[model samples]
Each structure stands twice: as structure tokens, then as C-alpha cells.
Target chain A: MSENHINISTNQPFNYCLHLADNSLIMGHRLSEWTGHGPMLEQDIAISNIALDLIGQSRNFYQYAAQLKGEGTTEDSLAYLREANEFKNILLVELPNGDWAKTILKLFFFSTYQYYLYQKLINSSDKQLSAIAEKSLKEVTYHLRWSSEWVIRLGDGTEESNKRIKNALDELWAYTGEMFLPSTYETEYAENNIGVDVSSIKIDWDKKVNEIFEEATLPSPNGEGLGVRSFGKEGNHTQHLQAILKDMQYLQRAYPGCEW
Target chain B: MILEKNISLKKIWQILEQITDPEIPVISIIDLGIVRDVHVDENNVEVFITPTYSGCPAMDMISMNIRMALLQNGFTNVKITQQLSPAWTTDWMTEEGKEKLKVYGIAPPVGKSIDQKYLEELKVECPQCHSKNTKLLSQFGSTACKALYQCQDCKEPFDYFKCH
Candidate 1:
């Protein structure tokens, strides 16, 4: 792995792939934090399993990105060695996991976005991306279903659970806007039929989320007025991302190309 | 790029059939439907395999195991390539593999993963007592490939190799 970061701007497809990869990697990392501390044994295992799936998906994307870069970069380098600013993940996934409700809500929101995104990506003109999308779509479908059930359970269960989930919805609603707003690379690739036009999926995403919320007996937070503020896809991220990087990149950074 | 043939493709596949999943030792990788294809071009051999799950830890081990198994069989030029297209589904698991899972105290996937039925609705018979009176404990289990379930009759909690 090279110590120098590869100039992602040189390659549009690479940037597009990184956006998808980073989202999964960061989301998977956040979910892995709850590995041992889940509310129960079953839930713990469930969250960990989901995390594993996301991480696995990220690996696929990173491997694709590395191949695209074709500059001696490997998936490990792309994942562990890249600076936080080089990441193209959306801000929503990089946010702190507040509570169990927050985590579940976040997973619900992200998986819903991914569910729709991968659906479109499966038809990408790019063969590798399409193949990856086809494979990952199955896993994302499972994730969306699992998180939806949890959201419904939390929202409609007890008073306290309902309150926490609603709070989670409100807290995370602001970050949802950026997912639909395409970055420069995304726009270019989407125009070429190589990447998903995220804006097109918002309606479906909204409908599914609203239906899930309704089933949970929870009122949907109004995301219409919440303008997109942060752009993690544009290499802009929250302060929380650096902290995540600190823990995640520590091994590779400290040891300088260490491997198990 | 062409060279004299050293081993038969049939012989290489016969070696792969001996390698079992590291996580689930009861079933061979061939029965699990992961070994997608095997191409033997003269002295070079390439095995194409697909992962059961995206983040399955066993894939790396499985790849290594396949290499070692082939190497032991005198095929030193083995190359393992992972192919993701068409994806993998539990529907591909052989009937013999499903029986092996049951005999190993694990329930095999009962229905197609594309089914709309809820986990509770799936009639996953208990591996221990072979009783239909079983309930889903969790959608996820000890690993990414399995779900947790318990038998109401025999009171044994077992793993169900989830339908992908």
C-alpha cells in the first residue's frame, strides 16, 4: 500500500465506486461498535451480522475501486490507509450511534437508501458494478427488512421505546437529504448509465419510509424542509468521522503496512 | 500463455470435493454450491468460487483450503478467483448437503429466500427431534449464514442455514 493517497479526482468511476464503498464501510464500522453491547444476545448477534455484511459489501466496492485506480492500490489501502477527507461516504452513516433506537433508525434509513440505490445499480452499464450490485442487493434487502422490523417494534412497543425511536427519527432526519443530492462524480456517472441517479429514488425511499413509520405508529419527521447541509460524498464529513478514523486506521497507521 | 497439460480437470474437481466448509464441516464446498467453476488450462488451474454471504469469514479460509487441497494433490499452479455474478443462493445447496446439515443438528433452509413469508411462518423442522413445532428465536444466528431457532418439543436451540 502506498503512503500517498491516490488522486480520486483523476477517475470518475473510481470516485463513484468510493462513494458507495465508503458508505458501507463507515456504516459497517459504526454497527460493529455495538457488537458486544447490544441490548440482548440475539440483537447483538444480529447487529454484528449486519455489520459483517456491510463490511463485506464495502470490500467488494473497494476491490473494484482499486482495480479502477490500477496504481498499485489494494482494498486494504483504500479502506484503512485513506485519509478521512478522501472518503466519499454520505454524512448520514458517519454520524454517532446515539442509542439502540438511533442505531436501528440509522440502519433503517441507510438500508432503505441502499435498497433503492442497488436496485438501480444492478442495471449499470458497467459490468463489474452491475455484478456487485446484483450480489449486494440480496444482502441489503435482508438488512432493510431487519431494521424495518426493529423500527416498528421500537416505535409501537412501549411508551419509552416509542419516545426514543421518535427522537432518533428527528435527530437523524437532517442527514437524509444529502443522499439524494448527487455529487459531481455521481451526476456524471449517472448520466452515463454507470451510476444511479439518486434523486430519482427519493420518491420510492420516501414512500417506503413513510409506510414503515405508519406501520410503527410513529409520525414521520418532515425532511422536505431540511436542506442538504453536509456533503460527505464530496469529501466533507462530520467531526465524528475523524474519531472513527482514529480507531479504525490506528493499526495500519501505527504499524505502517502491518498485516495479520 | 499455453503450456503442456499436467492434470485432468476431473481430478482437480475430485480434490475440491474433499474440502468442506470451515464453519460447517459437515458439508463439502461443492455441495454448498460455492465452487462455481474449475478451469484447467494445461499446467495452470483456476477455480472460480462465489461467497455464500458478503462478509463470510470462511471465504478466505475456504480459498486457502482449496489451494492446499489441490496442492496436496500435485496441482501447484492453482489460482482461486471469486466470481460474484448471478450471486449464490441456498437453493443451490444439494439435497445431500441439506441432509448433512440436519444430521449435524442444524436445519437447512426450508424455502426460497425470495419468499415473502415471515421467519415465523417458515416451517423449519427441528433438527434434533425432526418436529415441525419449532419457532424462530432470531433471524441471525452464530454466523452470517445461519438463523437461530429452537424446537418446542425437544427444547434444543439449533442453527438454521438461512436461505440467501
Candidate 2:
């Protein structure tokens, strides 16, 4: 829970936690773009709640990461004060919210990954991370279910819906490779049971994605390394992330330490 | 700082009972079964809470309120630890809390915990008309802890504090 058990490497857990936080933060912002714009009124509210959940998850990680940093850092400072290049979130999360089909499919992909990741993380020797993962796993379960249901509905429904989901899968497939690309901390932390082995989740991720896509009659879009792997984990990102930060970090940049 | 072995957990409970959930406003933290543990240490009081939802944003406010309440009530040092094991379920919400939710126009959670496959098929009684004919509009609702439902009988939409 503190800086005590992490004998592997001090920066690993902090960096790991920061990456998780950044992913959720950016995903929350992406999901928020759906506010008041969902296909139906019920869906509008549903997406907002999912966004809130992601934002809240990010806050927990950020708060913990801030504590780990221990030099008077706080959640707001970590979330809002950081420059675009400094964030370590994978590229999959920061892409633009394209269409309803795109958003739902993207969400399905991420939620599936999170579901498997948290399933393993819940058993982490790092108690705080374990607790956070356990708690997050429950929420992600619902998210996976909701988004997967939509993917199925859209994929099997009609010609137009099917076409959109197929296109989304192709557009988003390349970005997901970065999720499985292992970090250096995994070898040490995985040995200590304090962190997840990202590679371990890859099989589950693929199986889950394949099954869902199979059920929906959509082919697996992860072509044979057709897309270039962007090192978004190390802060390289598309032009889209800067635009997101322009809006997300605006108030914080304009008014430092301002609270509502 | 003198160790207060005389401090009672019941007294701490009384203090906690005064703190309402920031989001619901209708339910106290105790009513939602969030106050999982209370330890009156020598110089400090430690409270363990489990969040109703993993990402419920109100947890911070609730923790702050708890600290403030205890500090104001003479406990100088208060510690709040969030626990996530055995994940918090709607089943943890007290029966009294469930009643209050219905009175507040939100449907009380029906099951002890979610059987995810069956969640969609479960019939929830409408808070407004108490109709079992209500249909689920969305599994996610106003908050992560709720689901949106529509009562066919009364033709009204309500928030269901979803089970788990």
C-alpha cells in the first residue's frame, strides 16, 4: 500500500500506476464526448455513468501515485498539470471518439482488456493495487457487458450497423497492440507478485475479443502486424491527444490550483 | 496525546450516522454499509470503508466528511482506509436504506448480488407505482451504482440502485 514492499524498483509501480491513471483519465474524456449524444436517451445517461466510473478510477490511481511521489502532489495536479508528452497512456485510449459504433467498439476492446487485467491484478501482493484492481474489476465487468452487448447488437442488426462496427474494428486494431507490449517492470514486479504480467493477459484478451466478434459475425481485424506500433506507453502519441489536452487541461492551465 | 481506551465504537458509529452519502444525500454512510471497520487507537481513530461502486467519486468527500466529523467531535487524528476485498454489494445496503431509496423515488436493489446474466431479465418493482412490470432502460444510470428503469404501469422513469 505504501513504499515499503516495492523492492523491485521504486519507479516501476509509480510509473505503472501513472500509466493506468492516464489511460482512465483519457478514456473518461473520450467517453464524455458522448454526453447528450447517445443514440437514445437511456444510452446517453449510461455512457455518462461509464465516463464517471473511468474518471473516478483514474482519480484513485492518481491519488495513490501522488502519495507515492510524496512531494506535495495531489490528484488535480497530476491529472491537470501534466503536459501532453509527459503522459504515459497507451494510444488506444486517446483516439478521437469517431461514431457511436466506433465508441462502443473501442469501449468493448478496452473493457475486455481491463476485465482480464484486473482479474489478475486483484491477486497482487501490493495490497493497494490489489484493492484498486478488485474494486475496478467489478465496474469493468459491467462495462464489458454493456459495451459487448452493443457490439453484438450492432454487428448482427442490419447492413448499416454491421458496416460501421467492421470499420471501427479495422481503424482501432493497430492501436491495441501497444496494450500487450510489455514494460520493463514486469519481470521484477511479476516475480514479486506485486504487478501483473501484461503478456499473460494477451491470450485472454484475444480469446475474449475473438469470441465476442465471432458471436457478432465480425472477423478479427487484428491483421498480421499491418499497423505500425506507436510507443504511446513511452509518451509518443497521435495528433489527437494534443487536441484532447487542449480542452481537458484548459481550466487547469489557465487557473493553477483552482478548485470548484 | 493521551490514549483513550475509553472511546467507544458505538460513539464513532453515532458520529458516522450523521454523515450522509454525498451523492445519494438520502443515505448515511452507515446506511450504505460503508463503515466496515472502526478502530479507536491510542491517539488516532481509524475507519475502514468499502466503496459502493469501484469508481464512485463521492468516496473522497465521504472520507473528508468523516475526518472532519471526528476531528470536530474531539478526535484529533482520524485515518480512513479504503478496503476493496469481498467487494461492496447492494446487499450491504441496509433494509432501512432500501426503504429510504424507494421513498426518494429510486428503486431499491432487488437481489442480494448480481448474477450478471440474469440482471437484465430481473423484474424490478417501480419506486413510483410499485409495479413489477417495470423494464430496464439501461443497466448504467445516473450514477455507477444505479440503473435506469421505466415503469410500464405508471409510465415513469426511475433510477434503480442496482444490485452490485
Candidate 3:
């Protein structure tokens, strides 16, 4: 096979796996940032659980990626060794979790995309990919429902809460477009029915989001400039990912081969 | 001839179902989807198991329970093997287990039973009132695989079985 074809075959799955793994790892790390900073004790525990779930999902995807590479690369190595530009996650996941409203907004948007993505991935041609998708789709659905409800409550509640949630939506709106951008790797895998088509997800995402926004009495953001965010698939990332990597990879990097 | 083997397997299944989940006392490990296989060969019995999570603290307890159950049933040579591939998922939860959860006032998991994505999208019905108008009180419940939810109609907080 030509080098291009070989790259297309092998790296397609690898890149798709990385995107899935990175989404989980980055989102998990963001949730972990609220370890002791949540508004209440119960909410603190809740965020921690969300963090753990994401980390678990990341581990599953990373393990599968390692198997595909067939180089005995551990999940830790893939997670800790890759540079920010090498990561293939969407920018929305990498964005900083500014406040509770911002975090909720991010979760609502990401979970909606993930719910649809995994729904299609469950029917993937690859058995392992299908299994992972079959498993993760259940978790992401709960996450979407949880966050969507929060979006409604915060957006339609008190005047102050409503204003804060709206501000969060506006601030994070720029990053939403990256979630729908189909990468070269995704295109290749989608041809074989081994990966999901991002474009197809936008319709369901918009409908669900608009419904929630309408229920919350929040105005749907209207702007032609909304989808102009930098492309994360092309190695462009927000500054937040760099800071996130520093803390996330610290333990593995500090003491090599350290085991719990 | 074959009938005897079938009878023994059914008996083994019954014994296994009696083994309760260490973390959630109300449910059995068999219903929780941990026991994968059970086979008998002459005087030897083999039991295959998978953990809910890779490093779940309750695995030891589950193993001990299985051993004790078999020994008490006059099967002394029981071997338990752990299968890590095709990782265990919430989808393995039996229909009976799901119903038990609802009756126990915890919202059963819905959607791609194994995927976490479904946990985020599907509206968890109120365990107390069976209303879809329930809201999540917190993502974390008493256990790792559960979320706390409150019913808007009945105003009762219940646990939701979060997909792992």
C-alpha cells in the first residue's frame, strides 16, 4: 500500500480513538478542577463522580488505541507524552471551566454531541469500537439529561441566575462549532462505517438544544460569526489545555512507572 | 443424561444469585452482571467473573461469596477466573436487576446500557412517583454508578443508576 493509504487505514482509527480519548480526558480534567471548589458539599461529590466517569471512559478508549497501535504503548504514555498540538479533541472540551454556569453550559453542549456520536458509533463496523460505544452511549445519555436540566433551571430561575447562565452561553458559544467539524480522520473512518459523521449530529443537537433553551426561556444565540472558532483537529487548542496537561500529567511524569 | 447437566447448571445459577453485592446489599452480584460463566466437570466447578469496574474494591468480597456459596453446596473444587477483555458494563445488568432498582426507588439506567452518554440524555423517571419530570439533584449518589435525582411532582429525592 502507498504511504498515504497506509496512513489513512491505520491512523484513521488511531486518530478517531485519540479524539474520543481526549474528549474524555480533557473533560474529566476540567471536572476535577472543581474538586474542592464546588458551591456545596453535595455538588462537590457530584462533580467528582462526573470526573471519575470521564476518566474511566478515557482509559477505555486509550487502551483500545494502544491495542490498535500494537506497539505496547500504555494508556499513560499516550496521555502524558502527546503534545497539545498532537491532541485531536474538540475545542469545546478543552475550554476552561470558568464558573458553575460555564461548566454546566459546556457539559450541556458536549454531552449532547457525545450522546448522538456514541449512538451512531454503537453500530460501528469494528467490534471493539462498537462495544465501547455501546457502553459509553448509556453514560453520556445520563450526562446530557443531567446537564440539560441544569441549563433549564439556571437559565429560567432567578433573575441573577438567568443572567449568569446567559452570559456563560454567550462566552462559550464560540467553541461550539468545533464539535461539528468533521476531521480528515473521521471522514476516512466514516467511509468504512467505523466512525461517526459529525455533520449528521448537528441537526439532532440543535433540535434538542433549542428545545431546552426554549423551555428555559433562554434566547437561542443568533450570529453568523458563531462558527468561526479555530480548528482543534488541526492542532489548534485553547490555552486551557496546556495548563490542564501540566496538572493531569504531573504524577506520571514526576515519578515514572509509579503505581497505586 | 443431558437433563442432569441442565439441572446442575440451574442450581448453580440459583446459588450464585443468592450472593449479594457487597456495596449494594439490596442486590445480588449475579444480577449486577459480574458472574459470566459457570461450568461443572466431574468433581470440579469453574466460575467466570468480571468486575463492574477494573479496580472495584468489592471484587474480593464477591469472590469470597462465590467460594462460600459453592462450598456450602457441596462443591469443594470451585475455580473463579477473571475476564478483563470485553470489559464489564452496566448493560450486563439483568432485566430483573433493573426492575429491582426501580422498585427499590432508584431510577434504572436507560439507553445504550453501557455508554455514559445515555446517562446524560435520557430523562430519569422518578422512582417515587414514576414521573419523567424529575431533575437530577447531583450526578453522584451514594455509589459511584449512581446519580441523585429529585422528582418535581412528588418532591422526593431518589438515586439514579448511572451507566458506568
User: Per lDDT, what order, best first?
Assistant: 1, 2, 3
Model 3: per-residue Cα lDDT over A1-260, one tens digit each? 31223344553488788888998888888888898898998778867767777877788789888877776687888899777877878888888888899999899998998889988987888877787776566566657777888899998899988999988987888888877777788888888889988878888888898899999999976443246554777567878788888887788888987878
TM, chain A, every candidate: 0.95, 0.93, 0.93
Q: Which digits, one per residue and each the tens of the lDDT, describe model 2 over residues A95-151?
A: 989999999998998999899988898898777788788778778888999999999
User: In order, how many clashes per candidate?
Assistant: 0, 0, 30
List the candidates' TM-scores in order.
0.95, 0.88, 0.75
By lDDT, the better pick of 1 and 2 is 1
| Model 3: interface root-mean-square deviation in Å | 3.6
- Model 2's CAPRI class is medium
Alpha-carbon runs more than 4 Å astray in model 2 = A1-8, A222-226, B1-8, B41-44, B67-81, B84-86, B114-120
TM-score of 3: 0.75
* Residue A28 lDDT (model 3): 82
Each model's RMSD to truth, in Å?
Answer: 2.7, 4.0, 5.8
Q: What is candidate 1's local distance difference test score?
A: 0.89
Winner by lDDT: 1
